[model samples]
Every structure is written in C-alpha cells, then in structure tokens.
Target: MNAESPNIGAPQRPVIRQLSEDAANRIAAGEVVERPASAVKELVENALDAGAQRVDVTYADGGKTLIRVADDGCGMTAADLPLALSRHATSKIDGSDLLNIHSFGFRGEALPSLGAVGRLVISSRAEGFEGAQIAVTGGAIAAVRPAALNRGTVVELRDLFHATPARLKFLRTDRAEAQAIADVMRRLAMAAPYVSFTLRDVSGGEAREIFRTDAEQGELFGALAGRLARVLGRDFADNALPIDAEREGLHLTGFAALPTYSRGAAIEQFLFVNTRPVRDKLLIGALRAAYMDVLSRDRHPAAVLYLACAPELVDVNVHPAKAEVRFRDPALARGLIVSALRHALAGAGHRASTTVAGETLGAMRPEGPRVYQMDRPSGGAIRSAYAWQAPIFAEAPAPFAAAPEPAPEAVNYPLGAARAQLHENWIVAQTADGMVIVDQHAAHERLVYERLKRQMAESGVAAQALLIPEIVELSPADAAR
Candidate 1:
C-alpha cells in the first residue's frame, strides 16, 4: 500500500555528433552559395572588404560551367590562405563581438564551402611577398605553391555542382542565369559607386563595362545615376525624382520615379542598406504604398532607395542569401519610405498624362432654341389691332416667318479645342459621340491597386501603420471578415 514507491527514472537523450570539417564546410556552402551567382556575390564582397578599387567578374554558361572574380585589393599572404578557407575564420571581426559588423562579408565559410562543392583556386600576392597559389577540389586541399601573379587575388570556380548534379538541375537557362549575375553585379555597383566593376561572358564573347567611378569626384548619387542610366536605361534618369529624407535615426536617400514615369515591371526597384543591396518585403511594400496614389496598379516605379542606419537597428543575418532583413523598428523604416517618396513626388509636380484619338464625321446643325409658354388669363376685353403682338412676341420673331430665312444651312463647330483641366483633377471635353467625364482620383486608385497586387505577387507586401489613427466604425460581421 505504499503509493510513494513508484519507480522514477531519467529519460535517455540522443547524442549529437559534430560533422567532419569537410562535411560541415559543404553544409555551410549549401546555405551561402546556393548557385554560381551566390558564390560570385560572396567573393565580390570579400574583395570589396579588402579595399579593392576594381573588380572583374568573368563567367561561362551562366556561371554553372565556370566563374572567376579578380580584384585589385590587398591580396592575402601565403600564411593567410589556409586560414581564409577554415570555418568561422575571418579577419574582419574578433570573437565575442557579433553585433557590430563593418565589413560586407565577415562570415569566413564562403571560400571553403565553394571549394567543397566544386573546384576552387585562389591566387594572390601581398605587398612584399611572392605570389602564392592554393587549390581545392571536392573539399580536398592541395599544397600551396609559389606562382606568378599581380598584387591582388583571383578566385576561380569551375564545374560547379559537379559533385551535386541535383542542384545543377534546379538552375535556369544560361542566358537567364547570366542576367541574374549581371543584376547582382549592377546592384553591388550601385551600392559602391567608388568601386569599378567589369563583367565578361566567356561563352558568348560578350563583355560589359558594368561600373567605373572617378575616385576623386567621390559623388555617390551622380555615379549611381550614371551607372543606372547605363545599365537600366537613359529614360530612368529623366523621370526619376531625387529622395533625401531622415526619420527616427535612419537616413533615406536615393531616386524614385515620378508617377507618370512608372514601369510595367519592378525589376528596376533597387534597394540598399549601408552600401549593400538588399530585397526586403517590408521595404518594397512601403515603396508601393508611397506611390499608390500616383502610379497605376499594373505598373511599378523605378527607384533606388538607400537606407542608412546603425547596424544594431537592423539584422542582416535573417537569411543566408542576405537579400532580406529584419528591422528593430519596421514602422520607422516604412514611414521613412512613404514620407520621403511622397515629399519627392509632390515637389516634382507629378501628374498623369493622357491621350485620345478619333476621326471627324461631318457637320451637324445646332438644336433649336427651347421655348416656354404660360397660360393666359380669362378674356377681359378686345383691345387694339396689334393684339397678336403680345409682350412675349414683341422681343422675338416668328420661326416660320420670311420663308424660314432660306432654311439656314447646317454648320459644325469641331468640338472646339478640347477643354482644359478642371480643378487639376477632372478633364472636360466634348466629342461628336458625347461628353466625357474622368475621375482623376478614381483612375489613380485603380492604377495603384493593380500595381500593389502585382508587387505583392512578385515580392510580397510591406505593411505600415498610419501616423495618425485611422478610425472606422464597421458592422461586426464585416469587421471580422
């Protein structure tokens, strides 16, 4: 009868084992370098962090077959080569300090992960040492040997996804991949206008002068505009409005297109943070909302908005690709975008343009004048001989008099030079068909809605609260839905 004698035992737990260095590196590489473009991004970031003034990216067959990034920055010494490939190894930050990251790339797994998945060769030379070469294939390291090279690093990757053919199958076409690579390069070029970039396609023998900036000038906006004009097209420069605003310790600066100058696609909306290009849904949503009143729903605005703030306020490690980010105060970020863009558009006197086409038929007569008659009082007395010429008829002549005045031939007035804009919102005009009524506000609403839906489908929506409370009294069922 002893209820306290029940058996008690500790539950067994499964033991976890750390993966081997090679396996770990490969796993990390899977996250960092999902495709050849990702590898290119990581290597370029390293070169930029090394203070490289010029970066050259060459690739073949959409970078699946080969990719090489060469930079004219301070190259790694012979001793640093091995350390650079090791996991969790980086010269940028010391241990116990993960909050403040000044370099574009501080994670040291990029090179090794790439090496694990494919063939990787790194050649470099420091200021006062002979050039050195290090090679790795399928996570196997080769001996470092002396080689002839310049005063920088050249990282080459070949036969990507050869060890993992499954990953290769997910890749897009060669042209599409090449375009993605170019897009990545263009964004980076926009972020760092002081750096020079060159991209070449070895397979098609095509080359592009992606970016070139004058170091002495040191004008980020001008250089960005020039580069954007070169890469995106010249029309963007003509239609874009400059953005400069600050709020809640965050500074927003860049160019946004006028409502009249929107695009059918959002491929031109480039966003950057602390000189690094990113694609965050909240930011994109805020951008769409800012232009909602001006742009049509099916269209997207051309913009390049740079957001600068303390690193602690934003977390860039939310995604392995570093494309998306989480902000400590997302509302502040959204407000910055909406207010900055709204101010810029208003200052630019943004307006929608419209056109109409039609062919004239023939002349037509104007309608006869409308007439009204009143009932006469009961007859009082007979008066003069001109009784028929009463007061009403005294000021007008008979319609059938004088043989109908030769039946005056019909005439036309050519709809008289379409009326000008009424109150800046409505446009009044006359046509042979009928009068036309246009609601500027409603038209713009439709436009913005379509655009927002499209953007949400492509990149997701960014929601922000109104600065002022937006109160509404709705029925219970409707509110719940």
Candidate 2:
C-alpha cells in the first residue's frame, strides 16, 4: 500500500429490525404532516367525517403556534379519547374490509401522526355520555380525563412541528401559510355546501374571521347554486353553464364557464370526485379538451365541477394526502366530462345574457384592413358593425350600372346588415346590439377548411410531396433519421 493510502474495509452489514410504534408514527408524520396546511387538511377531514354540519377553524401564526377545529358532530366517549390519540386506533373502519371505505380520514394515521409531531388535545361528548379529553405531546400519551363540552368534538394542536424542528424551516411565511390555509378552507367549503364553515386568523391577539358561510340545505342544485354564487361571485354565476350529465352509473354535475368568460389561469377551476376536491391530470386534461374549440389556447375556462360514482369505481387511497385518486375507467371518466361539458357549453349560448361582452371581444383587433387603411371619421359615435362576407358587398359590375345601397331592413343577418366593403377583403356591418368587422380572407379560409374536412371525411385525404427524388446511398451515415 502507498504511504498516504489508508487501508479500506468492507461496507458494514445492514441491520433489519422493526421500528418502534413511536418511531413509525414519526416516520409516517413525515409523509402526512408536510406543512401547516397539511395538518389543517387532516384535522378538517376528521371533523367532516364526524358528521359535523358546522365546522369552525381558527389558527395563529399560520397554524404553527395554534390550530383549533371545533365541530358540532357526533362526539366520542371517554374510552375512545385515549385510543383516538393512539396509532391505528380508528372507529371509521373495521378490519373486516378495505373496499367499503366512504369516510374521508380512514387511514387512522392522522391523529397519531399529528400527535407524533405536535401537541394535540381532543375533547368530545357523545350523546348520552359524559364528555372526555386526552392530550398527547410528541408521541407521549396523556391520561383520558373528564371534560365539559356542550356537544360534538373539539381538537386543538399547538406548536406544530415542535418535535420535528426541520419541518418548521420548510414552512413558508405567516402570510403565505395563511393564504394556503384559506385555500384549503375554500376547497373544503365547496365540497360540502350543506355544511357551514368559518375560518379565523388569530394573530397578534387580534381575532379576525377571514371567511364564513352558513349551511345550505334543501334541493342539491339549488343550494349548490346559491353556495356557488357566494363562493365564486355573481359575475361567475352569471356567465356559468350548469351541467348535469350521467352515463354508465357515472354522474357529473356542476357549473362550467363559457369560453367568452375565460381566465388567464386555472386557479378558478375546482373539481371534486364524490365530494373530495382533487386536481388530477386526467380531470384537468378532459376539461381542457372540452373547451379546446370554443376557448383560445391561452385562456382557461373557470368552473366548479363535481363527479359522483360508485365507490368501487374509484380508489382514493393512492396518495397519503388523498388529494388525488385513481379511476377504475379513466377513459370513461374522460369521455363523460368532455362530452357532457361540450354539449352543455354549445347550448349555453341560448341561456347567455344579452351583454356587450361579445361585441367588446370582437372589437379588440386592429381597425385597418390588411392592405389599406380607410379614412375613419374621428370623434363621432362609432356605430357597432359585424364582419360579413356575402357577395352583395361587392361593387357593381357595370361602370354605368352602379347598384344603389340595399335597404336598411336587408341588414338583419346574425352579424347585422352589411354596411361597406374595405379593400375587397373586409366587411363592416351593423347588428341589433353591436357591430362586427369581418375578414374576407379569414372567412374564406374557414370555408375552405370546412370543405376540406367534408371531403376528407368522405374519401381520405391524399398526401403528395413536392420534394425531388434523389438517392445517393442506401444507408448513409449522414442521414438525418
């Protein structure tokens, strides 16, 4: 061996041993408790599963210092409190089967995993039983004791990620975390319209309610529409198209925004499967394809869509966070969404309100024709016009037989009556509500495209290349392929 070269030994043998329950829970917390928002999601899900019609969430320091979720739900008994803080002790499911899961937080990992990383207190009073409470701090279990409560359950978490200080470093600023918490609340609120939700921001000893909504009951769609209007705003409701479609036991319902009322980003799009909000690629792609034709490439349509199907048809356990799912028939899911929404959007034109929005979108283009600029009268009430391509706009054939202008009644087409032709390529017309300016060449292009489509459908399009034939070598090393 060289003088400076030290002796090398074999790698140490790996040890295979089981992890302690506390250690396992802490590991699970790494997956479950990603941030303060994750803790909020897990806690809220538990409350919803408890059959709470009203849920109130309050947090301070973006949930790092304190997070409390109180719900008027069916509370637990004294014996259940300690088990509720233990790992894998759940009342939501029986070990008899896993396929029958309908409840939201069924993994039985949320409470224990949360307890593993933070200080947790759960207090509940089931009907006909005395209220009880249990406290757990960093996987250390506390005795279950009698506690007073009106009804339902109350869970409070403090000093989140205290046991795992590294997680605190991963958390964003208070404002950002607060915004994320608000987003989580919004999604949950949209999912369960029948349930009331109140979210509060209690920072610096000041209590500020950030969001509040009362429970909506009665007809599903009626209540949902009212809730939607409240959450999404009246403008979105005004432009939204309602969709209720079903096929092969897969039901889809909710509202879709018109192409005319599109957005630059997809933040406004909300999707739910069986009342669980998810942002899946399959669902998003289906929606994108649904609006592919009516909406421009750069714009995204806003919507709050819901999907309902049998439990067996979808798997919600694919992710630890349960924010995504795997469908039994992805193609069917995609088809149902795309076809139903497209059909609804196509018919929504009739239900649309008579507004200047359509005219405004059409008038954004440059005023001049491609080749020439007609002298425009300035500072006058510019009449709305529609672009028309009918041959009547053409000049008279005979120099001495110039055609007199058509009667104003003749300009009653959808685009409005044609007014004048500019550069023989553009038409300006007037409509009952607004005016349109048409491009003759663009209209001709569409016409040609439709003609080609029809022809191609009848007899497949034939391909012909214009490249000259040249053969140098059978297998040239410089070949592009």
In order, what lDDT does every prediction score?
0.77, 0.81
- What are the runs in model 2 whose C-alpha is more than 4 Å off? 1-8, 350-481
Give the per-residue lDDT digits (tens) of candidate 2, residues 352-392: 33133333234432255555346664343242111222347
For residues 426-446, write the lDDT of model 1, one tens digit per residue: 545466667655545454555
Error of 1 at 21 (Å): 1.3
Model 1 off-target regions past 4 Å? 1-15, 204-218, 352-481
The residue-level lDDT of candidate 2 at 260 comes to 57
Best by lDDT: 2
TM-score of each: 0.72, 0.74
